[model samples]
Target chain A: MKSFVVARDLLREAASRRWFLALGLGITLMLVVMGLSLRMDVVDGALAATRLFGKSMNTQIRAADVALRPAFVASSYLIFYGGLLFGVVACADFGPSLLAPGRIEHLLSLPVRRFELVVGTFLGVLALALLGALYGAGGLVLIFGVKTGVFSGRLIVSALLASVTFSAIYGAMLTVAIAARSAALSAASGGALVLLGIVAGERERIAEFFDSGISRTIFRGLTLFLPRVSSLARSAGEIAGSEPVDPAALTSMLLGLVVFGLAALSLGIHLFERKDF
Target chain B: MRRVAWLVAFAALLGLSAFLMSRGDKPKKPERVLKAEFPRHPRDWEEERNRKRRTLPPAAPRPGEDEGIQRKRDPLLVALPVEKGKSSVVFEVAALKESPIGQIWLDCMLEEQAENKRRGRGRDDFKERFGIDLLQDVERIAMSSSKVAVLSVAQGAGRFDKSGWPKRTFGEKGAIWEDTEGRSVFATWGDELVLAGVDVKEIEAAIARLESKSPPQAPPIPDWSAYGDIYGVLSPEELADMLPEEQGEIAARIRAAIDRVDLHVDTSEDVAIVADVNGSNMDDVTDLAKSMGAALSLARAGAEDQGDDRLRELLDYATIKPRDGRFTVDVALPLEVLKQMGPCRKRDAAPSSSQ
Candidate 1:
């Protein structure tokens, strides 16, 4: 209950920021532009023609769902990557602001436990990420659905996956801010983790560069614990395309990301408990 | 003590999550099956030669020719005349004619010919002059370093009228026909084989080789490698020579680093072209493979930027895989892409007889 109060306080703080307003305006402008310029000619569930800004895009007739798959995939990837980048930038200061000297003292004086504060901040950032993803991905899905009459639920799922991915990234950022009390450091660490996660996704292929010896083994060991961020994004795009995906593998990956985020949040709480402000 | 315990528990949880994440295996790289091997001399050369001799009937010796030689029935492979260090390409025309893309190509060719005829450029009508339908008569066409041999169907050879050709010099097994300018030579052996080359002597040598009058040279491409609708081997020099002048630097680099490239094309459904690039040094081959892959990615990006969706779609099927001192580059055009991009689209729109 105390964590919920802290979370509400964080949300209230976020609602007053210019960053939230800017994100909302950006998505609205994009939706308006897309709705005005994109045109499709559908005949009997087949796409006969497509025009963007009055320029012919495709003349070959194909099933509407098949023709629009690339658009969905591109949107899913944009939401996945663009959302993570935006979250990293927007939520970077949240952790440092929460851990500021006066703010930390006031929060500690409340009934909220130190661990509750960390968990609340994490949940607050997660909610913000989910909201951003839904605004971007959902608006695009609605536009495409209204334009082509082919509604897909996969893009919504992709938006949720992007939010979960941001949670994992934000957990690390929170830990960094708790330890260093610097927004720059927090943002830098988050960016670095995102890059490392991408590399880890292609670890097996990159491992081929090293000769079969200690160097290769060390490379593999270092990347073993990193989250597969790019793989998750790719799977999201595949789902958006209605491609076959292994359900068991996707479940394991989702579970891994959640556990990893919790573990990072726990580490942040441990740091917060040890620090004397 | 509590802080230390918390750190330990975090580490344990990190390890557990990592284990769970690793369970979702990465898609394994497709295994490359090297169907073609580097061309080498057959070790059982003498034994195979003797066995071939024992199976053939003896031919009557000409005044200048050696005895105990025989005219063997041509099985298309025996007439290739490919020599050591030379390049060769064989097209299985009959098999290609049955494929969807092949039919489109033939229709396009026939349409062009008909258009040319309508324009009064009436010289290239093989059906009118020789009574041979290119779509149905030719079985396979093999082109080597200096010779081109077309193996006709059983009934195709009888359709040709030698009287219509230019001046000819009659030989014991075949005749070498000379063009009006005397710059080119065409030879016909038995009934089903027709060969063309720059020099009459080279054409005669090929006929002699087919007749077993001369010792057989090593096959430039092994018989087993010739499995697809089109198969060939390009020597390093040949590869360099085939490149355009704009790609001079690339041609030079290929000549220096690459040894040979074996090519095979399957046209059953999707048109797939696989080139096995072999090099002497493993690092050079790996670098070459990486360069090719990078080039493809750049091209794809350029196509996307230019909004050339057809080019982008075609490039999406290209892939390069390097394994053990060699690499394979594969480009496949799916049937749907072919139907969209092929000449058949215009043909389908119009009332056409070939359909």
Candidate 2:
């Protein structure tokens, strides 16, 4: 209950920021552009054609539901990929601001557990990202649904997956923030982790490029514990693209990513627990 | 309300994933039907079809047509002799002709012919001039480096006239009709088979191998039915020879690491090409795959930097992966890019009875 209160406060604090408002306005502006620009020509309940930005689409032709797949695909990719990128930027300051001299003193004076403060801030940023993904991706689903009368729930699935994926990256960002206490450094670390995680997902394939030697061993060792960002993103994309998902692969990848995120957060909490401030 | 909002948002996300999982297990509905309209302006329709083909997965079948009916289970590939130790290239023509892409190519050809007829430029009857209707008579065709053999239906049999035909006599074998203009010598195997090529001795050797029990050294016909419309096995050297002059060095390096290459091509929906390059050494296969990946990345980056969207799109679909003792390079071709190549139009313009 105390964690929830702290989380609520963190969110309330974030809402008052000018950057948060700008982010909301940016999302609204993009959706408005999409809604205004997208036009489809329906023939006999089938999507015969579409036009984007007054330029007619020449290739795509399919059933109404299937026709809206491109929209979902675009949104899912953005949410999973673009959301992580944006989360790094948007939540970079949340950590440092919480650890600011006055704020840390006040929080430590309270009966709140240090771990609870960490957990609260983590949840708050996660919630913020989830809401942002939903607003951006969900709005796309609704826009296409209203425009074409073909609604897909896959966009929602993508947004959810995006949020789930973000938790892992955000955990690492929080760890970096605790260690460095610099917003720029935290954001850079988060961005680097995202890239490393993506590479780690294809580590086995990448390792094949090196001859069996110390170089190959180093490559394998470096990526052994990293989250499989690309693999998870692929699963989400498949779900959104309406392609069949390999249940075992999807489940295992999701489990691995969640565990990685938890480990990163636990390590951050351990480090924060020993801090002088 | 604030506390409830967070819980509700989390629950909604979990619920959405559940919804996706549930729907995924359900079988998809059959594809929607479409009618085939005979193209009036063949050129324009060809352009339109080519433009639309980039969307992927091959053209959808016409209404009331079962695509499976066209599949041939026991293809004549069993008759192709794969010589060991020597370089060769093989093709599964019948399977290719039955593919969706094959049907589209045939229809385009027929349309082009029909247009020619409207202009009064060619022979009135294909069967009368060529002695066989390509669509109805020919069943399969296979080619090696030196020889070509065709398996045909009975209608195409004995159609080659021997009377007054210029027969070129070789040392021991009797005179065979020499099509000097076509640069081919034609020999019929009873009624349903024909062999033709520049090297008469190689043609005879191919026929001898076919007549004998399947050679112990013969290369296996790759099972590519699940992967693509056309499948083949070729020596690395043969594969390298097919590459453009600019990539000769890469091709040579690739050939050094591999003994045989299995190729599968699907043009039915989207243009996908998969090449499985087998090498004896695992390390060599891994190295080869890396080089190929690097080459492809360089090509993609170059395309992007140069603002060549088509090349970049093509490169974006290329994947190289190494497994066990072999590596595979898969490339997906964009139809719009292929249309720009003018290959189909060039073939349509070739001399034919209709023209």
Question: Best by TM-score, which number?
Answer: 1
Candidate 2, B173-272: lDDT as tens digits: 2235666575666665545655666766655554454344322233345323222344566777767887789888778876788888777666655567
Docking quality band of candidate 1, CAPRI definitions: incorrect
**Against the true structure, whose lDDT is highest?**
1
Q: Per-residue lDDT of B1-355 in model 1, one digit per residue for the tens? A: 8777768768988998888888874653443322322222223652353245233344355667676454443345565666655778878787788887888777676776777788765435655655555566667777887555545444445334543666454555566676667576766776676777777777777676667644555456655566577877888788888877865766776788898888888777778888888999888876666656555655666687899987876776666656778888777776666775555666665656455
Task: Give the TM-score (vs. native) of candidate 2.
Answer: 0.50
CAPRI level of candidate 2: incorrect
lDDT of model 2 at residue B151? Answer: 52
DockQ of each: 0.16, 0.03
Ten consecutive residues with minimal summed lDDT in candidate 1 chain A? A58-67
Model 2 ranges off by over 4 Å: A58-60, B1-355
